[model samples]
Target: MVLKKLVRYIINKYLKDYIEQLDYEKLKLDLKNGHVCLENLHLKPEALTDLSLPVTVATGCLEKFTLIIPWKNLYSMPTKVQIDGFYMLIVPKNGK
Candidate 1:
C-alpha cells in the first residue's frame, strides 16, 4: 500500500507537466512484475511545449498508457511503453 502511494506520487509529480486532471483513481501499479498503467488521461496544451512546434494542442486524451519494466532482468531486457486510443486536436499558434 505504501509503495503504491509512493509510485503514485512519483508518477504524478513527473506527469503533472504534461497531463491535465490526471485521475489517480485509474492508475494501476504492479510492483511485483513492474507494470504501470493509467487510463483516460487528459493532456494540457503545454504538454507539447518541449516539442517546440508552431502549433498547440487544443485538446488531447489517451485511453490507455502502459509501462512494463523487467525488474528481474533490469539490465538485460528493455522497458516497454504502449499508448492506446490517443486523440488530439491541434491548431496553429496565432503568431506562428
Candidate 2:
C-alpha cells in the first residue's frame, strides 16, 4: 500500500527527528496498522501557548491522522488547522 509506505517514511524521517528532541520518559510512539500513535506525551506550557494550535495534515490511510495534544498545551487559543494533500499547517486563528 502506498499509504503504508508513506507512513513508514514519515515515521522514519520527521517523527523520529521530532521524538529525539523530546524527553524519552515523557513520550513514546507506537506503530500499528500503518498508523503512528503518540502516547504519554508531555509538552511545556509555554510551548503550548506559542504553538500553532490548528494543525493540518493529509493521510491516505483508512484511519484519520490523530494528534493528541494535552489540554495544558492548548492554552485556549483559537487555532486554524488546514490539511491539503501532503501538506499540514497549524496557525493562530485569525478570527475567521
Candidate 3:
C-alpha cells in the first residue's frame, strides 16, 4: 500500500498537469523488469503553460510511453524513456 501511494504521488507531482487523461486502472508496472508503461494518454491544453508560449495545444495524444529504470544500478545507470505515436496540434491562442 505504501509503495502504491508513493507511485501515485510521483505520478501526480510529475505528470498530472501534462496528462489530461490517465487511466490508473490500466497502468502497468513491472518491478522485476523495472518497466512502467502508460498508454492512450491525452495531454492537457495547459501542458505548455509553464513555457509561457503563445500557442495552445488543441489536441494531444500519447499512444504509448515506457520508462525503463535500472533499479540495481539506479545511481549509475541513466533512466530511459520511450514514447510512441505521440501526436499534438498547436495553434495560436488568438486563432492565427
Q: Write the per-residue lDDT of candidate 2 for residues 1-96, one digit (tens) a residue.
A: 564455446544744422223333432333232224434332222232334565322211111233333334356643222222322233444455
> Which lDDT values do the candidates have, in the order given?
0.88, 0.35, 0.85
Q: All predictions: root-mean-square deviation over Cα?
A: 1.8, 15.8, 1.9
Q: After superposing candidate 2 on the true structure, give the runs of residues whose Cα lies further than 4 Å from its correct spot.
A: 20-36, 41-96
Better of 1 and 3 by lDDT: 1
Q: What TM-score does prediction 2 earn?
A: 0.24
RMSD of 2: 15.8
lDDT of 1 by residue, 1-96 (tens): 997888788778888998998787888888898999999998999788899999888999999988888989999999888899999999988891
For model 3, the stretches where C-alpha displacement exceeds 4 angstroms are: none
Worst 10 residues of 1 by lDDT: 3-12
Where is model 2 poorest over a 10-residue stretch in terms of lDDT? 56-65
How would you order the candidates by lDDT, starting with the best?
1, 3, 2
